[model samples]
Target: MSSLKSICIIDDDKIYTYGVSKIIKNYLPGNDVMSFENGKKALSAIKEMEQNNDELPDLILLDIDMPEMNGWDFLNEFQSIRDKVNKEIQIFVISSRIDQKNQEIYRVEWDQKVDDFIQKPVQVEALKDLLA
Candidate 1:
């Protein structure tokens, strides 16, 4: 697969963010990787980009649990404004909340916005495939 230009990582773990960013940078040189401590900040940046007519991230690595705004709420908010954006953004849920897979909420909100789900301590091989 071809490489993506911009990738966003939304998670609270600084170590996880740094490690993942390193892997992505090494694996896909020249790719733009940005990180947000929480979904609220990520969403705000994305919305601002929209208003400024700037290019949004091509892919987003999302976490289910976060402060200020959880991944679910972020997804909802993003989906609400999707129509206003012209680009296709692929969102992959990368969270440690494996139990969420069995919840009814996944079946509902995930049907449209989320492209796929990945467990935390994100597997390099799987991530490589996504980044590929």
Candidate 2:
């Protein structure tokens, strides 16, 4: 598998963000890892990077629920600017609210927009498999 150059995690939970970032760093040392407390911050930062012609993240793990701008809102905003992006981005929706109905809805509405929908408390093995 190809090594990822950078990763971004958009979530409000500090513990989950820290744990996921640590796992990513452990697997891909020297990789660029960024975390945001909400989608609004992540979206703004990404847009700024685009405007500056700076490097963008290779992957993003987004949470469904957040204080400012949820994952769905982020995706909608991202779609508008996706064509202007300098690099390809792989997005994964990571949420703890994965019931059968929610899973079905995600599969129907976001299957093509995102790479995958993963349950929270994201595991190293699962991440390794996906990243691999």
Candidate 3:
């Protein structure tokens, strides 16, 4: 598979971040993989990158529940700055909550904003497919 230029993992769970980054590095060596503990931090960093005319990540794995700013809030803020970023970013929500109601809400409300909703403890095959 062709390597991706960059990927961002926004989650407070350190173990999850480490595992996902490790998997990404194993599959797409040399590609940029960044980890942010929360949506606010990621947003600030991305905004800074935008100000400096730096390239943002093409893909983002976001967690719904986070301190400072949650995925829902981030999506709302991201929409405002989407055009400012040069990349056509794809955001996927990776959360532990995957009830039918939540999925339905995503389908009806967040369909345009998010690419996919993945369950927590992401599987290796699923991650590979996502990377592909």
Candidate 4:
């Protein structure tokens, strides 16, 4: 695939963020990769960028479970901001907690907004495919 302007990852796990960011940089070095510890921090940064009229990331990798604002909350709040941004941002929900209960919740609550669902411990080939 052609290079994206930027990609954002919102997750509480520092190790996962670092590793995934590294992989993206290695494979798509031209793109900017950003990470946030949780949804709240990510939303703050996103709002700041929006206020500044800055270019937002083309893609967002979101984690389902986190402290200080989880993925579901982020998605709900993001919808309003998204309309004002005038940019098409693809949101991919990446989580390790896709049990039956959560799957039903996601299907019922957010099936339309999310571009895709990626399970945690994402495989290298799958990541490549995503980038491609």
Candidate 5:
């Protein structure tokens, strides 16, 4: 697989972040990976990168729930700057929530904004799928 120029992981769980980062590193060595504990920080970082005319990440793994700003909030902010960044950038929802209703909402309402929905405790095969 071709190496991604960059990727972002937005989640409140440190363990999840570490695990995903490790998997990404193992599969796509040398690719830059930026992570944020919440959506607010991630949004701020993206804005800064935009201001500097830096290329946005090729993909984004976002969590649905968070303390400061959730994934939904980030999507709102992301829409505001969508034109400033790469419109083709892929965003994958990674959440531990098992709420069927919320899943339906995400599938129906936010389908256009997100690429795929991945469960928590990401597996190596799933990571490989992402690479593929």
Candidate 6:
């Protein structure tokens, strides 16, 4: 896979973030990986970047459940700035929820917007695939 300049991870779990960030750093040294505990903070930062006309991250690792603003809420708000943000910015949904019905719903509902959905306890292989 080609190198990514930057990636953003928006998840509430610190351990998960730490683990994923570590793995990413190990695999792709020098890549800028930013993590946010909630969607609101991430959104605010993205908006600020937009205002500054700065380039967006190449990918966003988004978690479905979070406080203040969940993944779905983030998507709703993100839609407003869709044009402003780089269209190449891919969003990958990561969640622990294993409900097949919920998965099907999200697949159908957000297929066009979200690049992919990954179940939690995110695998290194899965991350590799994404990076690929």
Clash number for candidate 5: 0
Model 5 TM-score relative to the real fold: 0.91
How far is each candidate from the true structure, as Cα RMSD in Å? 1.9, 1.4, 1.3, 1.6, 1.6, 1.4
Stretches of candidate 5 exceeding 4 Å from the true structure: 99-101
Q: Encode model 2's per-residue lDDT on 80-108: one tens digit a residue.
A: 66777656789999999987788888889
lDDT string for model 5 (1-132, tens) is: 665558899999999899889988987688788999999999999999889988888889999889899999999889878865555788889988836777787789888788888878788888777866
Report, for every candidate in turn, its global Cα lDDT versus the true structure: 0.85, 0.87, 0.88, 0.87, 0.85, 0.88
Model 6, 1-132: lDDT tens digits are 567668899999999999999998897667789999999999999899888988878889999899999999999898788866546778999999846788888989998779988889988888877887
lDDT of 4 at 43: 96
Runs with alpha carbons beyond 4 Å of true place in candidate 2: none
Name every residue pair that clashes in candidate 5.
none
Scored by TM-score, the top model is 3
TM-score of each: 0.90, 0.92, 0.93, 0.91, 0.91, 0.93
lDDT of 3 by residue, 1-132 (tens): 766668899999999999999987886677789999999999999888888888888899999999999999999998877876556899999999877788888878998899989999998889878877
Q: Which stretches of candidate 4 lie over 4 Å from their true place?
A: 99-105
